[model samples]
Target: MISLEHANRIVGATLEKGKALGLKPLTVAVLDAGGDLVAFARSDHSSAMRPQIAMGKAGGALALGVSSRTVGDMAADRPSFIASLGPISRHGVIPAAGGVLITDGNGTLLGAVGVTGDTSDNDESCALAGIESAGLKAKN
Candidate 1:
């Protein structure tokens, strides 16, 4: 489980990282292992769909047990399969690089963090930064 405190830290650090990199306005979502939203935030200028996109990224990672980057790769290799997941998944599966799974020191799954509103790589960097800032490990 991800405590609200850590979830908030992840959101803050993710946004801070985006700002530091001079990236576009970002939206972030943190989800627990069971794919439940723990915390979420969207920058003022973020697009309307950002909230759903962020949650999808995080939820997809949690559901698939892999980073969203890997999901993107899978989409490339198996488009139909990845696309099929969308209809069944509650948050939908977003095949992007912004979603990352979080773990503890001993490799216990904790939660996932997702970021958006910038390039996929940049979004992923922010997610990684946020996880690190919280002293958690990213299963990237």
Candidate 2:
């Protein structure tokens, strides 16, 4: 389980990293173990679609129990099967970077953090930083 406070901290850290790096404004999302949103933040000037993109990344990570980067690879290898997932994931799954799984010191899955509005690598890095800022490990 991920506490709301923890989610908030993660989002804050993720957004701060984007700002510090002078990247485009970002939308960050934190999800609980069950893939429900726990906290979210979108920076000003970010595209309207950013929130949905961020949520998709988080939900995709939670559903697969792996980083979205891995999902992206899987999708790339099997486009048809990945496309079939569309109906199942009402919130959608973005099989891309920027989504990372959150784990505890004991390697238990806590949740996930997703970042958008920057390059895939930067978004992923920011999400990892957010997880690290909360003293959690990112299973990416």
Candidate 3:
């Protein structure tokens, strides 16, 4: 479980890392193991779709039990299969980076963090930084 405090910390740290890296304004969404939003934040000047994109990234990861980067790979390998999931999934599926599963030290699934508003690689970096700042482990 991701407490509200942890979720907030992750959001803050994610945005801070994005700023530090000179990336674009970022939107972050933290989701519990059940794929429910725990915390979310969108920086000023972020596009309107950022919230949905962030949620989709995290929700897609949770739904598949893998990082969104892996989801992207899967999408690349099986485009039709990945596209078929969009309509059936509650949060939709975003096959891109910046969505990472969170785990405890014992490797227990806790939650996930999703980030958007920059390049996929940069967003993923911010997500990892946020998870680490919260003293949480990122499921590889």
Clashing residue pairs in candidate 1 are none
Model 3 spans with C-alpha error above 4 angstroms: none
Candidate 3 or 2, higher lDDT:
3
lDDT of 3 by residue, 1-140 (tens): 89999999999999999999999999999999998899999999998899999999999999999999999999999999999998999788899999999998999999999999999999999999999999999999
- lDDT per residue (tens digit) for residues 56-129 in model 1: 99989988999999999999999999999998998999999999999988899999998999999999999999
Candidate 3 Cα lDDT to native: 0.95
* Model 1 lDDT, residue 12, Cα: 97
Better candidate number, 1 or 2, judged by lDDT? 1
Give the candidates in order of lDDT, highest first.
Answer: 3, 1, 2
Candidate lDDT values, in order: 0.93, 0.89, 0.95
Residue 87's lDDT in candidate 1:
89
Model 2 over residues 1-140: C-alpha lDDT tens digits?
A: 98998889899999899889999998999988888889999999888899889988888888777888998999999989877875798557898999999998999999888899999999998998899998898875
Report the poorest 10 consecutive residues by lDDT, candidate 1.
38-47
Output the number of the lDDT-best candidate.
3
Cα shift from native, residue 45, model 2 (Å):
0.8
Q: Give model 2 RMSD, 1 decimal.
A: 0.9
